[model samples]
Target: MMALQATLQHHPLLRATLRSGWRERWSFSGDMLPALRWREGETGGLLPQAEEIDLRREAGLKVYVVQDRSTVDVTFQFHHACCDGAGIDRFTDDLMVHYAGLREFGKSYKFVPTVDPNRLAVRGAYGLSFFRTLKRLPGQLVGLMGAAQFWGRQPIPLLAHQARDRCTKSTKAYPALTSFLLDPSQTLALRKAANHRNVTVHELLVCEFFCALWDWQKLYGQYSERHWTRMMIPINLRDASYRSLPALNYVSSIFLDRRGDQGGDRDQLLKGIRAEMEVIKRFQLRYTFLFVLNILNGMPWALKRSVQQDTCKTSVIFSSAGKTTRRCPLPRRDGFLHVADLVLRDIDGLAPLRPYNCVTMFTLEYANRLKLNLHYDAEFVSEKQSDVLMDLFVAGLNQVADTAGTQL
Candidate 1:
């Protein structure tokens, strides 16, 4: 507990609180760290759901520790306005390192605090000059127009039955989570399959997700040639220069729009995604989203009104948090990461759910194993439907792995 608290003191953003009014700002204080919440039991088993954090009155971060006999599970929940997935990973790495140092070296271990923690702010992180942003404005405008046209047509939700009307009446957002894991062998096969096709594992995963969604929706007779499947892929904007920055929101997204007819064939869909992703990377088109955000930042009323009237622009938000182990300072014992006496068995977290964008997919690779976490708004999607969708996704990946083995 001491190490954890000490670690939080080093990151300014962790202790900051959100202050809203005409203009919102983050207020930081030395004595504002949230007390750690600890529980005893098997966190993996069925249990009563915890209440959601109210960011307006509390800190933007929450830490919970669950200890069950010999196993310990730690979960961190952060408001999206304060941090991104990469930021969470970075913070976890620091926490483990702190705990390990305190346990091993005891009194001799001295902690080093982050220098100029205020620099972690998203300001100037996009690396876009005023002139450059102006140059990109036209292209971004065109893309927004294209997105508006698609949204005007009303893209179908992942589930066949719509619950937006019923869900809107509820004051609280009830987000539910479900997850599955691929063993090292299965993960290896998937990687090999990606290599055989000259595509990245990330690209392959996206393609498989699209295919799985198509198949799952077809079961409910939701498949239509006119319907479009829009997905938002978050792109981390942190380059080598911003690598040392603390956990914060330094991410943008690239939208992928595909018609039902376009995603019917797996190979063709993969080909199209690969080419589109290449173009997005080659031209650094991810900055286009950031440019629009910068413009909105200056107009507070416009941003507020947009959020209040926000509709689900995309079918799903998919984030691939690749290889978390690489950034960790702690050593692995047996097959799991160990911090002092605690063995880290698993790491799973949910992406935030929005009004219409109820379903979000988060993927993380740890200990050479790939884990997929599905988070959905309970008001929007039922628990049974979430399970079926996850099953289809896993089945799609297993099919790819099996095909790879046959080729071998």
Candidate 2:
């Protein structure tokens, strides 16, 4: 705990709070360390209580430590407006380094924070050239026209029949989470399968998610022509130059739009996804979303109005925190990462739920194993249905692995 406090004292963004009123800004606060919460019990059911961190009154980040017997689970909850998944990974790496040093050197250990002045400069991180971004405008405009399929028609919800309320009435939205793990051997099989298909692991994961969700919805009689299933995948903008930056939001996203009637075998789906991703990469289209956001940032009223009028532009968000163990500076003990006296067993990345987009999926690879976590609005998806969705996703990956074993 003392090590964490010492680390936070050096990180500016982690010890900052938002200013009130329409024009908001972050102000550094020295007392943020006291807000850390500690509890006793196994961490289960990722649901946020109403009394958790309030960004308006408190700092932008909150840390919770839950201990059960000899095991410890640390959960970090932060406002999405402040930081991204990669940012959290960076912070965790720093925290582990500090903890290990403190344990070995006691009070003699000194903490030095990473310094990057351009951390908050999003455009700088992307190295966005005016002429370069402008040249891709036409292609992006065409993509926007394609995204119109989701404008008029409502995107299919995960489990609409199980909604507890017609509309989410809580002042704060808390996502309920369920997770499953893939052993190292299974993880290797999936990677080999992706290699066999000539697609990246991320593209393969996206294909499986789409196919599994399609099959699950068809089983429930929710498949139709008019409804669309649009998924948003966030792209981290930080490159090698930004490696030393602290935790902050430096991310953009690409949207994949597919109609409900577009069902096919896994190979066909993977092919289509790979082609689209190729176009996105060739054109550097992820920056298009950031360009629009930059424009909207100037007009707070229009931004607020657009969000208020949002009609489920996205059905789900799929984010991957690739190879988390590579970013940490911790030693391994019995196949698990260790920090001081505690053995780090598992790490789950939980994506925040949006207003109309009730379901969010996250993938994190740690210690040669892959873990999939699903966070959904309980009001929109039932607990049983969430379990079924997870089963379908895992089954899809297992089938791919089984096929790879026979061919390769």
**Model 2: per-residue Cα lDDT over 275-358, one tens digit each:** 989988876677777766666768857767766663566778999999985866678865588888777888877887776666
Cα distance off (Å), candidate 2, residue 141: 5.7
What lDDT does candidate 2 reach at residue 55?
Answer: 70
Least accurate stretch of 10 residues (summed lDDT) in model 2?
159-168
TM match of model 2 to true structure: 0.88
What are the RMSD figures for all models against the true structure?
3.1, 3.3
Please give the distance, in angstroms, between residue 8's alpha carbon in candidate 1 and its true position after superposition.
Answer: 1.1
> Can you list the residue pairs that collide in candidate 1?
none
Error of 1 at 227 (Å): 0.9
What's model 2's lDDT at 339? 84
Residue 152 CA displacement from its true place in model 1, Å: 5.9
